[model samples]
Target: MSLKAWAAKHYARRVVQSDARWMAQPHQTQEAVFKKLIRQAKNTAFGKDHDFASIKSPQDFRERVPVRDYEQLRNYVERIVAGEEDVLWPGRPKYFAKTSGTTSGSKFIPITSISMKEQVRASRRALLHYIHESGNTEFVNGKMIFLQGSPVLEKKGGIYYGRLSGISAHYLPAYLQTNRLPSWETNCIEDWETKVDAVVEETIRADMRVIAGIPSWVQMYFERLQSAGSKRVGDLFPNFSLFVYGGVNYEPYRAKFESLIGRSVDSVELFPASEGFFAFQNQQDDPGLLLLLDAGIYYEFIPADQFFDDNPPRLGLEEVVLGKDYALILSTNAGLWGYNIGDTVRFVSKDPYKVVVSGRIKHFISAFGEHVIAKEVEQAIQEGIQAFPARVNEFTVSPQTAPEEGELPYHEWLIEFDQEPEDLKGFAAEMDKSMQEQNSYYKDLIEGKILQPLKITTIQAGGFDAFMKSIGKLGGQNKVKRLANDRSTADPLSAFKTT
Candidate 1:
């Protein structure tokens, strides 16, 4: 066997042995892990302020440390940025992962040495589990390319700041780096258009066996490769077999990606954020990702219907019920205490807990009390696309509440299509019908004439791309919000209208 293949098999065997005990009794494992974290950080400033010494259990921990958003935790993070010791975690954070904010320009999330190690460990476990499950070591034997952000981190206040992907690239083990494609210089190019060209030039001829990135960016790279005289991705890299993706739902882009590659490729989805590496797809047969219970993060769930309530009940791992949508809350070794990361998820399994990301808390559309979410919209679009002879490149939706005096409010859809439908009006009607069937509130609104049918506006081929680039959020983990509560996102998209 090849050296890389042999190493992969050995790693997979070790992961299986290590993971068996935890999977057998996940509840006990999670409880013990949570207690260990509490004891470790009880002396920190945040812990002291919240009376962590008095906390005895999950109930006590919740009562002591109230759930907080980024804005609510800004003060503590700022103190850490000013070089305070033991402000949140034991020592100063190693780096600050910068993500786009709603009101704030950018959010700087702390990353400690312990949290960094956990991130690396969780990622490695995910790959090892995949290898053990599939019995595929050829991927590890060949080159793997991860299309990440610029690795040249920017320093601020004695701490480095960059995209989470960029920060993660810095932590890749030396052994794996030897077989990874795309040189450091190519990865450090800030401009995405330039960076993609450099990546293609450097790795097109390499024996690429695995590729990882956000679906949209990776699709863009595949298109670039196809344009360079390659009929399909497999034509350029015959051994390419695994595709790892996260940051957005892959369903909408699945067909497009498969079409680009000229065949189906095994894929693994991950639920990672700037806050922490949460979960990853562990089994090939199951769609849900296995929750990292023993990772340095303690998890809590609040029902989505009650998330905005004045006193939403928090549920621990033992309290969660399968198939219910809940907004995820975290208390991590990174020093975040009951932090609400705004992502919603649904539990799919109990024994070895598994979950599927439902949507984002802020990305819902409930202006008229329809309570529509990203999942609903995505499903509606998927159904609607079936009646058409085209493919959706990208799309976003918003409520049009500012109708004329006699008219009712309605939903507006802005879409950029790679191929146009033969009958535009039929396609729009199909989408509206699908949505009405899925949401009782929406159906009621239509029956009562409180809202008009959804309006569809087609944009030029590269309209969404142009908008993202205009806002300096064109590439690498950045995605357009699929649904907006207001016209803030949809209004700007109209500027790129094709007709």
Candidate 2:
């Protein structure tokens, strides 16, 4: 083998060894513990349906409450955002988490006292399991990194479609107040650059150890850190113990993160959402533990094909089977019952309900883990095109595969523009480069020859707006859906000429 190839192999083996350090936490009593909470949540939601609130004789919460989408929540969300009380929650909520979903633009979810209590405590409890990764997690008092987005500062105090800004502002520990991000990011300034700068300053000033947030934003933080003369995180915070993240797959960011940080810190996958703090990666090397917020909310898992069913299989805490992929349904303390959050995950084991996010069954690409999820791929494509001088007025990503001539399946981007691409060829090449650099799985897949390289297709201006208009999704709360996994918008790239 060539020396470079041997070195690459050596490095891959080592990283795998490091990743393999994670071990599953034993689930001796977690099922019984979480099930009781599920029963109580059901009782709280609708006074129980067909023994639904019975721990000994459980019921699927779905039978009691039909699934309601955000459209059903339009009035309720407005009321909460307007700072009024409504059926969105049982009572006046304490806070609101503005998270965006695949189909929706901005979701201003209500955070009730009960739901907050459930989410916060469950988040803390999940940390206890993260201790397994630390080799000594209890006493992990060190600098941390929170790679989160700038907070959204709206006068209405309504929840919207961003994650870090409002939620972390309210929940950051008092001890970490000095470490909190500046108010400018959370204020009403509309400039993305200004907001990024404020957060970048806070990250640099704190000498943080534990980093958290979406991988893209975190990478921006690290890039800014490099410009500020701090390349390795070890140089800034030798006491760094953990790197926490969620929102998208981590494999792509791993290499870049490691390269930037210089040392391997325990990476934790926290399954938190605007609605609830779901599951967490408990072990350092292994998959995480789903510490079901036993008290915070009740959960229902519907099979993928049965989502539209009059009688869908809805499994509750005690009854949820292991190794099955299910669409997660939640009934939160904020008064959302039988709410489908639009993410699909599978139970790896259930004594403690260990699970993995399989994919967004609705928003994800149908390809093998190429994972062209809507929001993320859109963002990545945006970032990818930053290197190009062209003004990207519109773009769409769709699944494409080889023709009868026979080639691998891949993702292709059809971008529409105002200014002609300064370097159309360059942008396409750079787009794939940026994506590969960001996701390690994509890199491994590419290296293993699992996928044909991601391809970009450019089109005339106004095309994106035309497409969005066709879908009746024009303007403020609605953006054109990019990164479709199916052949809905255009034919799957099967017939396209291989680039």
Candidate 3:
């Protein structure tokens, strides 16, 4: 091994040991984070307004602060944008991560210096843990690329603002900076197509290893690489061993990715957002992501079923039960208190606190009272693909409440396939059967004649990409909704539908 690789492995050992120590005391670590956050933000505008000074326990904090989404918390965020100090956190944030919000058009999530450090630390720990367990640090000597947004930022009110990925680009550790791919000028290109072309030209001949990004965007990059070089990704970059990804589940994209690469590659799944670095995959063999309890954020869970209740109970880390879905809430040192991020997760393990993101609270179908979630649909499709060999590139599920003349209402699945099954109708039937087995409500609706069996609408190759491009969200952490309660996304997809 090279000197650098040796040093990285040595550091990895220490990081893994340290993580084990804190993870053993999940509740205590969370309590420390909670107390620190409350004490530090006591004098802030939001803290003062919520009476944080008198808050003594988790219940007291919960009673004082209501769970709020981005729109509900905009008043305080607007103050911060207007250059107000101590409005949310202890002082003005170092940067604002700009993201597209559902109800609100754009959101500016504060990234305090402390929160920024925690993000970097958690990311580092995840990587070190991988190295420590696998004893593979040879990739450290080669190029590593994070297929990300532009590193460019817009400065306003003395704070830099950009997409979370772009902001993170500015903070690459000194060791990895030299090995990172895509020239600075190439990264600055505003248009995603132009940027990908530039990236392909720049990194085509480099010794690339360890690619990281959301699966969809990475798929685009891989396609570009394949088209430009006429070689499988594995052949083109033989050193590429680790594929790090987050933002969406990778199972649906796994077959397509393996086809593109011509082989299976080890991967690490992360649970990160502009709000905080929440969790990372600690074991390569495990699907569950290890939640970061000691990482400057206090977590709360509301039962997914009870989330719509007027006063859903906010359960602490210790109170969460295995296999039950919960809407994740966060109170961070970045000054977001009791913030509802909309994503729902299920506890897979409690021994060291690991979770699997189940779905989104708002992104589900209940038009016929079936209440089908993203996880169920994803699993159904995966099982279908497994039973009948096929490779899916992209897909989404939306209720088709109105059909022509004599047709009954049904769930419409719009899928873009890299390799379509020989018996498409049979594939759809298998998927429908899987969904019925998983969700009793969906099954009841189908049996009662309230809804027909799900139908598959094939999207032409590149149709999903075209749709996203048309919406100006083609790249940089943008994701097509896996489940839509309405036709907002489905209507636009009509143009891309294959006969």
Candidate 4:
């Protein structure tokens, strides 16, 4: 280990680790409430899709609609370019979320008014759940912190739709207008530097109570909160009760956030996007049961096994199997009528139709049946280092063929350790062991000698940052992407950048 790195580690251990605060309430299991919630979602969303005629079962609806992916939505977006109001949302949209694109440059997703209302309703339900989880009600007393994309109502230079899909500035909550740090919309820049700076200034100034936004953005906000430590929760906003987040998994991030902030903050999860606010993590135990906003979009699940298969099976709400994985499809108040949002999830156990987020359907490497989902990868890393302690800032895994002929696809991991590993090879093997434990498919593949050996590479601090910069994605919103799933090696740099 470098002397400098070792020194930094000891200092951090004393300051951050020793004083870390973790506050969690046992997740609540409100089966009856959640079942009523899902039923409401069915009636509101499906009711409209069937022309206000009540659809009794998830099976009845599934027979008529076919399963689809994000590509199908992109085609609808193209039609929107042709000046067709018949986009996903029914009436005029609030605006698109303008999410950073994966395949192409950027996608201008449409968010109709009904969709926006449905989405907002989901947010409200999430808030109620947060209150239930935290066992507090301070939100009514203080400013709620909403860390969101601040794109405005300005028209796109080109004919095509830009960030503001169909929404206007009038949609922002009235309380936030005067409360916003930067009074003008001009401060909203696509650049990370200006955006983070402006956002940091706002959090400091507002001393926001109920913090909410994308998990990645919230991570950046917490970093700023750690740096700007003078503002105490009580001093800044006495009523501060919840720290709501969504858009990505929070498991790998939870420990770091606790250490940096030096306090235990409660959180709520929302399922908001350009499409609509469809669900909310209203129950603590039900991290993924998503309380469907009965007022917004109609929700359905397609069996995960049917994905990318010749004959896909679309399951109605009733036909959904408990303790199984499924991909989500939605029909909402927004013009998006029966659209699939390209997200996959699993049912942990259900009475109230509760489930845990398994992982994104597309975001994994299981071609030869290794079956490594995003959550499994995160959990394996956590399990591998339970002995004593080992700090990991970030890690990524890519499936690839060994750098030789006749080689099968192996798991390659690039991790930034807080300190050097005592036995790099052992750590990788230990991680593999953990992988085999959590996922049976991977265990079988490994035992069968089909999947290649697990490979590990150490990196200096800020290795991930350097990689993000190379891809022109600096600061917030840049996520860890699994670049390869098979023998394909289109861009090696896409996996992880090195010195």
Candidate 5:
């Protein structure tokens, strides 16, 4: 091993040890974070309004602060954006992570200094843990790339504002700076298609080892690389060994990625968002990501089934049950209190508090009283691929409430396949069967003839990309929604359907 690699491995050992201590005491660490957050922000406008001074326990917090989505919290956020001091966090946020909003246009999430530091620390520890467990620090010596938004920031109310990924770019550790690929100039290009082309040109010949990004955008980079050299990505960059990703479940895209790279590489999954750096994969063999109990965030969970209730039962770390899905709520040092980030997760293990992102709280279908989520669909697709080998590049599911003459309402699956199954009908049947098995409500609907078995609409190669490009959401933290309750996604995708 090179001197740098040896040093990294040595440092990784200490990081693992430090991480183990907090991981062993999940609830205690969370309580400390909770207390610290409440104490620090007690005097802020939000805290004061919520009577933080009187808060003494988790129950007190739940009673005082109602669970709020971004829409409900916009008034306070707007005040902060107008240069108000001590509005949210103490003083002002270091940056505002600009993200696409639903009812509100362009949401700005505050990234306080304390929160930013935790984000950086959690990401670094994820890598260090990998090195400690696998003892594979050789990748540190080679080129690394994180395909992300441009680093250019726009100033707003005296705070730097940009996408969370862009803000993160300015905070990359110095050690990785030398090894990071795709020159800064290329990264700053505003147009994603143009920027990706530039990235391909710059890193085509480099010894890339670690490539990190959301899977959909990274797939574009991989395709561009393959098209440029007519070689599998694994062959083009033989040293490429680790794939790090977050934002969306990667299982649906796994077959295509493996085919593109021509081999399976080790991967680290992260559960991070503009709201907070929540978790990271700590075990090489485990699918669950280690919940960051010691991070500057306190977590609460509402059982997914009860999330829509007017008064859902909010549970702390000690109250969460394994295997039950929960709508994740956050009370972070970043000044978010009882915040619903709209992600749902299931605790896979509680020994050290490990969770798997189950689906988005809002991303599901219940058109015919059959609630099907992203996880169920993704797993069903994976099951189909296992039963009948096919490579799916991209896919999305939505309820097709209206169909042609004599057709019943059903779920429509628009699939972009890199390699179509020899028996497409059988493949669809397998997926439908798997879905029925996973969700009993869906099974009841299917059996009762309220909904027909899901139908597949083949998308032409590059169809999804074209749709994304048309919508001006082609890259950089943008993800194709896996499940839509309505045809908002399905209709747009229909334009690219195969004849």
Candidate 6:
């Protein structure tokens, strides 16, 4: 091994050894971590308002602070943005990770120094754990490309604002900077088409071993690489071995991605958002991601079935049961107290808690009480594509309300295919069957004729890209919503349909 690879392996080994005991006692570790965070932030306005100084336990914390979404916390966030110190955290946050918003154009999530450290530590530990568990360190010897947003952050209200990936780029460890691909200048290119082309030119001939990004964008890069006369990604960079992806389910894109790479590579999934880095796939055999308990975030879970209740029970790590879907609530060192990040997850294991992200709380279709979620839609699409010779590039579903009386509302799916399916109607039927099998509510709706059969509209190959581009959300951390509760997203997507 090269000196850098040897150093990386050694460091990873040390982290694994140190974290093993804590991982075994996740509940206890989390309790202690939560207490420390409470104590640290007790003097802040939010803490004081929530009676944090007197809160002795998780239950106390929950009772004192109501669960909040981004909209509810916007006032305090605005204060911080307007140069108010100690409004949320100890002082002004070092940066704010910008994300799409419902009311506002964007939401700026504070990233304090402490929170940034936690994010970095969690990411490092995740990578190290993978290396330790897999016993593979050769990839560390070659360049690892992280396809991320622009590294050049926009300064707004005296704080840096950008996507989580861009914010993270500013704090990459010195060791990683040396082996990372794509120069800082290339990363600053704002246009997706232009930037991806530059990325291909810069990294095509390099000894790349690991590529990390959202699967859709990574697939785009791979296509561009192939279009530049490369037969496959492996042909251009034979050493490419690891693919780390998150932000969307990988099942639908797995086959297409493998075909582009020309071989199967080790893959890891991460559950990270603008709020925090929550979990990562630690073992190859395990499909669930191990929850990061000791990270600088205190977690609470509200059962998905009970989430709409006025005062649903918020369960701690010890209270969570296996195989139950829960909406994640977080109290972070970044000054977000009792915050609902809107993602739902299910605990697949309990001993050392491991979870699979189910879907987003808002990203569901319940127009006629079917309550179809992102997971279901993804799985159905995967099953649907199996009935034909094609692969799903991207897709979104929304309710198509009846235009006139007596017309039944139905789910409308706008799909962009990597290869056009031979039998589009058959594909739609398969998807309907899959959904009926997965969700009893959906089955009832279909059988009762309360809802019409799902309507599938096949879009041109790059329809999703065009839709995102039209909305100025074409790349870098902007994901196509898998399921929208309304026609707001679906209507615009329909405009991009292929002739």
Error of 1 at 139 (Å): 1.2
lDDT values, one for every candidate:
0.88, 0.58, 0.92, 0.57, 0.92, 0.88
User: Model 5 reaches what TM-score against the true structure?
Assistant: 0.99
Candidate 6 Cα outliers beyond 4 Å, as residue runs: 387-389, 403-407
RMSD of each: 1.7, 11.4, 0.9, 10.5, 0.8, 1.7
Q: In candidate 6, what residue range of length 10 has the lowest lDDT sum?
A: 400-409
Q: Whose TM-score is higher: candidate 1's or candidate 5's?
A: 5
Better model by TM-score: candidate 2 vs candidate 5: 5
Off by over 4 Å in 5: none
Least accurate 10 contiguous residues by lDDT in model 4: 18-27
For model 1, give the RMSD to the true fold.
1.7
Model 1 compared with the native: what TM-score?
Answer: 0.96
lDDT of 1 by residue, 1-499 (tens): 7887888889899988888888888888878878988998899999899988888899999888888999999999999888888988898899999988777778999998889899888888888888898989888778999999888888867999998899999989888888887998889999998989888998888999999998888988998998874579988888999999898888778777777888888998888888999999998889898998888898999999899999999999888999888999999989998999999999999868999988888889999999988878888888777888567788899999997788889999998877778998898899899999988999999889989999888999888888999888888889889998999888888999986
On TM-score, who's better, 1 or 3?
Answer: 3
Estimated TM-score for each candidate: 0.96, 0.63, 0.99, 0.76, 0.99, 0.96
Residue lDDT tens for model 3, 178-283? 9999888888888998888998999889999899999999999999999999999999999889999999999999999999999998899999999999999999
Candidate 4 C-alpha lDDT tens digits along 143-192: 55555444455433223233331242345556446533334442356676
lDDT string, candidate 6, 108-195, tens digits: 9999888899888888888898888887899987899999998888887899889899988888888778889799999999999999
Better of 4 and 6 by TM-score: 6
Write model 2 residue lDDT over 1-499, tens digit each, in one string.
Answer: 5443344345445543443332233222334434544544444323343344443432444444577766666666666666654444444566656655446576667666666666666555445445433434322344444444444534445433344344554666565555434453433344434545555666565646566666655655566667775457557656666676776666535645666778777777878776777777766667744545445555667886566677787776556666656788876656666678887787786544578776565766647675444435644655554666554444567766653367877777776544555676777777777767756677777788877777766564445444544665432223344557666765522232223
Predict model 6's lDDT versus the native: 0.88
Badly placed stretches (over 4 Å) of model 1 are 387-389, 403-407
Model 5 agreement with the true structure over 25-83: per-residue lDDT tens digits: 88889888889889998999998999999999999999999999998999998898787
What TM-score does prediction 3 earn?
A: 0.99
